[model samples]
Target: MILKDCQRAALEHIRQHSAARREVAQETIAHLLEMSNIAQEDFPQALSSIQSHARVALHFHPDRLSQNLTSVADLLLTDGLYKNQFETFLSNGALSPDKGGYRDLWENGMFGEVYMTAHVTPSDRPKYGALNLMLLPDGPSPRFGSCYFLLKPHVLPRCTFSSTGSQLNPPEKGTLDTLDGVLAALLTESFYREFALGVHNIRTRQLIDHLRDNLTKPFQDPSTQAAARNLDYFIEVQVHGPIWLADDVEILVADPSFKRTKTGMLLEKICEGYDIELFWHCGFVLNVEEVPLDFRGPKMPSLARRVASGTFLDVEMIGEAAADLKRHPERWRDRGPYEYVLQELKRLWHVLVKFGKPNNTQK
Candidate 1:
């Protein structure tokens, strides 16, 4: 184990932050310990995705009614593109300690003891799912999303200010330049990231999914025949991007279900006569971490002092329905359930628009 003076000071800063939010801190530590192998260069996006799930997407009810972390975790799992990338990366031994010609910090760093004990609470044995929130055999159930390592300060290029939080600037210092300083910064950042991501994921899954689902109807088209046709426009969106009726066409058609042959055929037929030119802006996605996603978490003011939130399915024109309920709650004055759910869904969508950017691919 190696410790540099700057790393020690950074750890002290993290230790202080962790004390106030113990549950989040513990989960964050658990993430760090398990995912310590992720390379900083390839998958910094995972941190943003994880944080999105953890903090803004996850949820916490009143303490009296708060759900168990495992159950909450299960509900928020997403088998999206990031999940697939993580699996491929892990399966490829991309996270193996020996890959960098240096053993991972988790295996030999000063924090090795911390990694072993990151799972602080003695928890129930939840089997691992295709993906996981917790890394191993201890969680109550398997989940579909998770985190892994990013660049540590030791590997961080010198004098480069890292928004990744692996490099921290103390009150008296500009940035932690040495290996130890980076480690300290990494620990503190991971602690906050895990806790934040958990909360966010729960909120999005529980709250946002409902609105999107409610306002949107499931694929009820009975056509199951896979037909061959010119899927040029449909494929063009995949190759390009477009918006329709004020909604991003990609977002409207983002679900993989639309990828089915019949579904693809149906989409083409719907706009057979429309003249829509696809826009091409396949420029590299900005380094999102450098800008940092401003997901609604502890740092943001609450959207509602108390918003009644719920999930809905089998609804028609969900967007319109949600707007109706929000604009005219009195129309369903006797049906508070209907009105409140709509309002909640609208709020969730609002959060997504303000803070969530659509992915080009669903998974």
Candidate 2:
């Protein structure tokens, strides 16, 4: 069976099983059919099988549309803090706009700046606000980060702490290299998290665990093994917000650290081993208030006076500094400790990707 004939039959089955979902399924199937027609000559048996699969899908899962929407809403709510972080970064000029600043920014400083809103009541509609996150150079070097955020009343957030090289001296000279590395790392992490979220929804824990176990396995083919070895390392995490809902989480990336030289090295290594090409870009949305604020020292006052003043705003120092000490602790001791939450996220991703696969063994 030709691929197009298979798609047509499958779509017809969908149309029969779920009249309400026909429009949505038809549009998608049409595109697939068009692509298949352009690539293949003819295959009648394959077409019959495809139609059978479509029929099974439509009959077995009619509520998928609503479920998908709910899942997306949940992610947005849970990752509220991360969204806020991205928003703050973009608004503060820390990141550049790309594609006119659509939900997120691109590497070229262009973004569509899209906004979304939901109606909570007949008379009251709340705006979800805009997310204008994008990647921009941190300095003159090839160092960049995807900055993004979400907004609501009376909320201040901060971004998570991740490592990065020092800003470049002549920012323009290496902007492209830095932005590309950052974007690639961002995409890798984002995709990883997205895969996890999808898998978790279907309650596919065993499948997820299987994939994690295979991460260290050697490929039977040398070429495949080489490619896998060259792939870049990335960390994806679920950003939790104040909300307690299950779907209220967003995925974020933490690696590629905006270090151009290191990113280049990683890319070269991957290229040597695999035939794969990396093209996607990733952006993060985090709240700025979540980040700890920095404080300055007093100039004219004695060390004791400066310590007392710093303790007032810094919770970490309040208890320790209350007592008298022979030697004052360093400034870092007074501030909150840096925390890395990326590991927890990676675990979640490990689960989601498994769920994304088709149920059939043939997949």
lDDT of each: 0.24, 0.22
Off by over 4 Å in 2: 1-25, 34-80, 85-252, 256-363
TM-score of 1: 0.20
Each prediction's TM-score against the native?
0.20, 0.18
For candidate 2, the per-residue lDDT at 77 reads 32
Q: What RMSD does each model have against the real structure?
A: 22.5, 21.9
lDDT tens per residue, model 1, 1-363? 233333333344344433444455345434554465433332233333322221111001100100122221122122111121111222111123232222233222322233224332111100111111221111111011111111111221112122221212221111222122222333444444532112222221222233223223322221222111111100000000111212211111112222333433333333232322211111111112222225333312232222212221111122334335545656655435753454444433333323322223311
Instruction: Supply the global lDDT for candidate 2.
Output: 0.22
Among all windows of ten consecutive residues in candidate 1, which has the lowest summed lDDT? 231-240
What's the true lDDT of residue 323 in model 2?
22
